[model samples]
Target: MQIDSTNICERLCNKSIRDISWLLNIPRSTVSGIITKWKQLGTTATQSPSGRPRHMTERGQRMLKRTVRRSRQLSAESIAKDLQTPCGLQNSTTTVRRELHGMGSHGREAASKLYITKCNALDAMV
Candidate 1:
């Protein structure tokens, strides 16, 4: 399903913007933009995004991971505190939560906490 550069060059090099738009089933504006970018940048590739960089370094991320792995039940506030004490990374709880999310670790209640009915039943039996 990939479009070959040589095939595109052969088919679309001489075609008008309207013709390219019709052939590609895309908007004329998009075609024009692509052509303009190609002419100016000499490539149709995406450029690097402009924005503020991440607050966490590789060492900080590793420390976060280690902290999380060491104590799965720890809260974001606690993790942030832990990171700030020994390490000089003054990240907020929200930032720790975000880093945890990026690492594929989502916020989840423990199994024992989730089964309130079971705990209630045991208490009633006692």
Candidate 2:
């Protein structure tokens, strides 16, 4: 790593990027990006030690919603069953429920056709 990057990483290890940016006279985003890259490359400049991985994907979200929409009154277990054959998504009913809750569609609306366009997802993410 560059000397400047090393200094920035040292600062980031002890301080938040906002504080390091102010002290070292660098952009906060630059410090943040460098730290993220280090972590991605398995060099831990700064981060929590570990956490559970994310369970569902965008496709999984749409599939779960469509499954629910198709069988409006099915329990989470039944929904998980329906999903197994169609999309090969096997999770505990609890897992399915949590993913549905995260997607903002738990027990609220009838399962209907919902499509995820690339533009829409990009807009949501960024």
Candidate 3:
């Protein structure tokens, strides 16, 4: 198990914060904060962080994947247009490109060959 400052504080319950900090090699303020948090919250665990939400939903991502699978040759601009029209998602080409990249799809197709050679006689001699 992890040895947090709380464990250190619990072990040296009668010791001062500075003494615990010196023994554990932790800053006094950090050790004090952990002990304070444990006393107040009854746990040393951290809370989840809050952040901005995603621009695209799960359904929209699925629709975008389906559209890309249906037409592999579609450009980012065309994909954005299709998303706005049929999929009812109004995202920019850059956003569509970013999402495609995030989904492991670069929207680039393999080059097609117009002709094939059976053998190269000169290469065989070399």
Which runs in model 1 stand beyond 4 Å of their true positions? 1-12, 57-59, 75-78, 84-88, 101-126
lDDT of each: 0.81, 0.76, 0.79
Candidate 3 lDDT by residue in tens digits, 36-119: 777788777887778977788898899999999998888989888998987688888888888999999965558996453446
Worst 10 residues of 3 by lDDT: 1-10
TM-score of every model?
Answer: 0.56, 0.46, 0.55
Candidate 3 regions exceeding 4 Å error are 1-32, 42-51, 85-87, 107-115, 121-126
Span of 10 residues, lowest total lDDT, candidate 1:
1-10
Per-residue accuracy of model 1 over 32-123 as CA lDDT, tens digit each: 77667767877777767889889899899999999999999999999999999897999999899999999999987756655559879899
Reference-based lDDT, residue 32, model 1: 78
TM-score of 1: 0.56
Q: Which candidate is the best by lDDT?
A: 1
**Order of models, best lDDT first:** 1, 3, 2
lDDT of 2 at 115: 91
